[model samples]
Target chain A: MHLTSVLVIGATVIALLVLAVYVIAVRTPEGKLDHVGGMRLVLWLGAIFPTVVLTALLLWALPAMRPLPHQSGDLRIQVQGEQFWWRLRYEDGNGPGVISANEVRVPVGRTVVFDVTATDVVHSFWIPGLGGKMDMIPGRINRLVVKADKPGIFRGVCAEFCGLSHALMAFDVIAMEPSAFDAWLASARGVPARADGRGAELFSANGCGACHTVKGTPHTAMIGPDLTRLGERRSLAAGTLPPTLESTAAFIRNASRFKPGARMPAYSAMPIEDATEIARWLRSADGEAGR
Target chain B: MNRDPLKWHERLRVSLWTLIVPPAVWAGHFLFSYLWASISCAKVGSFARFPTLFVAGTVVALAIILVSGWIAWKQQRMTGDPPPHESGTQIDRLRFIAKSTLLLAGLSFVAVLFSALPVAFLSDCR
Candidate 1:
């Protein structure tokens, strides 16, 4: 049976149960409402029967949901959900794995544990193809286990109704070959030069430091995405925008333009030359890590 | 219409829609978001919202509403009828059905449905 069909059938069963209670209610005697007998029967069936059934279902589901008792040696990824974007820090500790936004790539046929949390309002972490959904709440860490039976892209969204643009806040999961993943991670961590250019100058001149942070640089802001390796990420704007250079430039210049009510202010009204220069500087500064 | 015993469908309709729609919508929205996140991040986890409590509350409340409305509806239907209105025997029979059916079995089922819905749906038991 199709999965969705099961959901519908379950819902139908609930409806049927409710209907049964209503029918029983009409059978009660007039004026003298018995708090004990007639009501007790309906309440018991309505309440108790479902309790047992649901408890059984939950017991059945826990093992599949939790990590298997002997399961070990899996990969861990720290996934942080900010106001309107997703921040990823791989647990490798060797160096930063691809610091991309909205795009998650993992090796196929391995259990990946996602340590997820929200920096702002409650955001739910969900992936339909892999398993269920976990909430990313401030001050609370939720763990999600995902195993891609094969190499494919899975779609995910913020299950909680966050503030504005919540509908637009989405992401993707890419499961690929182990070698391909390692190669991508290597390229992602590669350092670029801190050459004297338009991007570097704007990095200091613009008020970008108030929200974003860059390691070993003057941009110490932690209110937004970490830019220590911004250029290395697959997607930009917390997965709201694609990872293309043009999209990154547009987001830097005017994030609200892409996602309305975005927290980031737009630099579109700034001098066109300045915007272009900043874009160019950031574009070149992509791989300047460890330089 | 058999005039021997009362019917409960009308009262149950109110319980079904009023108690069911709002929370069901909430669950639906949550489910949609989880599906989106899973696809985007390649991570699957249990949905963390307390939708079960909300749904259970709705069902329980609906049960209350159904009982109350059923009494009113039964009174209206049986008015001016031939049955003895003031006798305790009739009361006992009514109590038996409510105790046996609505309260015990019916309420229990609603609670069960509430908790089961999320997990069932989470597993794509849609």
Candidate 2:
């Protein structure tokens, strides 16, 4: 079915749920909002009826939404929800781990279990086309089961308001063939890390390591997402922009321009020469093979 | 209606339940998970802690709602000298608003708890 049709159907279901509530509300006594008076009839019908219906829906949707293995052999991925972004670390025990930010690539026709958590404030991990939403609550771990039935790109967003840049925080799920996905993962794991040249030297001297991490290097700080496999990621700028050398450079030069209230400081205080050098360094240093 | 001591006591009881249950259930959830994890780690199998916790939380939240309803019943009984105006209408409106908000919150919390069920139960089963 067309995606919009599925949406329409879902909308109809929600409308019915609301209608059920409204019917009960109207039958309720005229005076008080609290006491239903004769409205107990509505409450009984509305609340109880929907409870049964929603429960059925939950059961029906469960298999398609997050199918558990009736037997065995399901892929498991760790999905970490950070303030304003998603850290997708794909592990399969053979590769160096394909660490991508914002966009996640999964094989179609597979059930994937996501171990989700939040590094900062509470955020919800939701990809409507895949399945139900789960919160990324701090100090707690939440799990989501999702399936990518078709090979296509679907938009995913941080459904919970995290902070000033919450609305801008978004990601894409790229469903690919199992072979292609494995290839991508291997390539991402094998991508070599390079020195930032003049830019690389300046990046560290400029104190970017205080926040972001570049694995197998001195910048081991955990304040930000690991940038080890950034080059292979399809989008950058916290999923706000498509991953491109130029966009990545621009974002590094001035993160606040695209994401207002971004936690990362802009290179605004630095001179243009240094800023450009830093941006270049970032582009070069990103996706460099770990030493 | 003067400030009756009995009314004050009743209100206190209602407020105490309202203030207490939500947080208590939240704490219960954490405690159950920690214990479940510990036990599961030790290899002593049991029903998933999450589902059990979910059930417990739901029951507590439901109790809160029923008591709130009972408080409304009590208020109705004690409101001897109606407001000389449409007191029933006014009181009903207030009650509906309060109940609606509470029910909404309670239901949403339960929904989240339900998701945690599978995770909690399967922690050691694997």
Candidate 3:
């Protein structure tokens, strides 16, 4: 059974016992016990009983308080908390780190250590189902070690109250089998295949390359999130919208409409057809080929 | 070594201020434990492997509280007129203070143990 279930059951039993004692005390006739008798009762029931119970409980829970043991060879993921998004880099000692955004993937049953920090302000990294929350403070790295017992997708959110649009900040946590995770990581490290079309032309024409990076192309500057594997991500704009053609186009055109105080400039003047074409190019499988 | 109950009670000289001793020890232990944990984390990046100093501090605090409680318990058992102890006699006053101190000592003993619990469990700052 889960630890929470055990705790809840224990608490319920204790509450029922306390209630029974209360009923017995209330039903007793007046003057049935003298002051000395009452004192003895309080000494035994209130003082000694609680001390023994609490001591036993403390001993029982002591071993469980220790965190999962980690070694230097374990996979380390560096997560930096920005104003409205998360920057992730996975280092597994195989090759150069794989940089991604707004999502986290870990191997099931393997210990994953997160070296979490912040760039601008204080943010807390929380995935409630997996482990405890760790504060991401600027300039200081806080470590969170976790081992996913099962393979599934979970949701993680910024627990701290960052600036405007903080409520919109969230990410997906994907736990996969070890072999699949290795395959994904190997594929994620290679450069993406080049995309060429009217949408690709418009993407360059709009100067999107100045901020975002798409590997295997000349758009190497990374002021914004890397768009190499944009097509594979489950959500858009740091989980603000679905990864659909229209939603991506709308977000590209007027990002501030969906998220207030977004850093991306509002391209309201750009033609709707042009935005849709760029979104299509980005969402195409060939556009996300290698990374 | 006097066998006279009244003389022995007077010799001990229990006072109203003695009531604060047990809880004060608890509070001191509580503060020291937190400070030790914080300093250890900040300096060494984790709690000490053995934590001998923390263990020693806890032992001393528990010993002082136990001694206090033992004294109060002995005083509480002294023969006196029972409840509705409204009389202003010296013996009644001493007995009342002793009983209150004894209860507080019991509470403090439990609190000190609780404060020491986290150290026994967590080996790291996380």
Best by lDDT: 3
Q: Looking at every candidate separately, what fraction of the true A–B Cα contacts under 8 Å does it contain?
A: 0.00, 0.00, 0.65
Candidate number of the best TM-score: 3
- Model 1: CA > 4 A from native: A1-72, A93-100, A192-196, A207-221, A228-235, A242-247, A284-291, B1-103, B106-126
DockQ of 2: 0.07
Model-by-model lDDT, in order?
A: 0.62, 0.65, 0.86
- Tens-digit per-residue lDDT, A1-291, candidate 3: 566887898799889989998998899999998887997898887878878977877787777668888999999999999878898899999899999889899999999999999998999999987888889999999999999999999899999999888889888899999999999999999976655788788989999999888777778776778777788888887878887889988999998899898788999999999999988887775454222
lDDT of 1 by residue, A121-212 (tens): 89988888877888898997777777777888887788898878887777778888877877766756665454566666676778877777
Off by over 4 Å in 2: A1-67, A70-73, A95-98, A193-196, A215-218, A244-246, A284-291, B1-126
lDDT of 2 by residue, A1-291 (tens): 464786689789889978987897689777655444445656666576767766665555444433344223456677787767787777666745566577788888877878788877888888887876888888877767777888998888899998888988888888999899877777676645666477667768878889877765678676676776666565676678866656666777688788887878877666666665655555564443221
- DockQ for candidate 1: 0.04
Error of 2 at A239 (Å): 1.7
| Highest DockQ against the true fold, candidate | 3
Q: Which of candidates 1 and 3 is the stronger one according to DockQ? A: 3
B13-72 in candidate 1: lDDT tens per residue? 233334344334435545544454354344433343445554555465555545544553
Clashes of each: 76, 15, 0
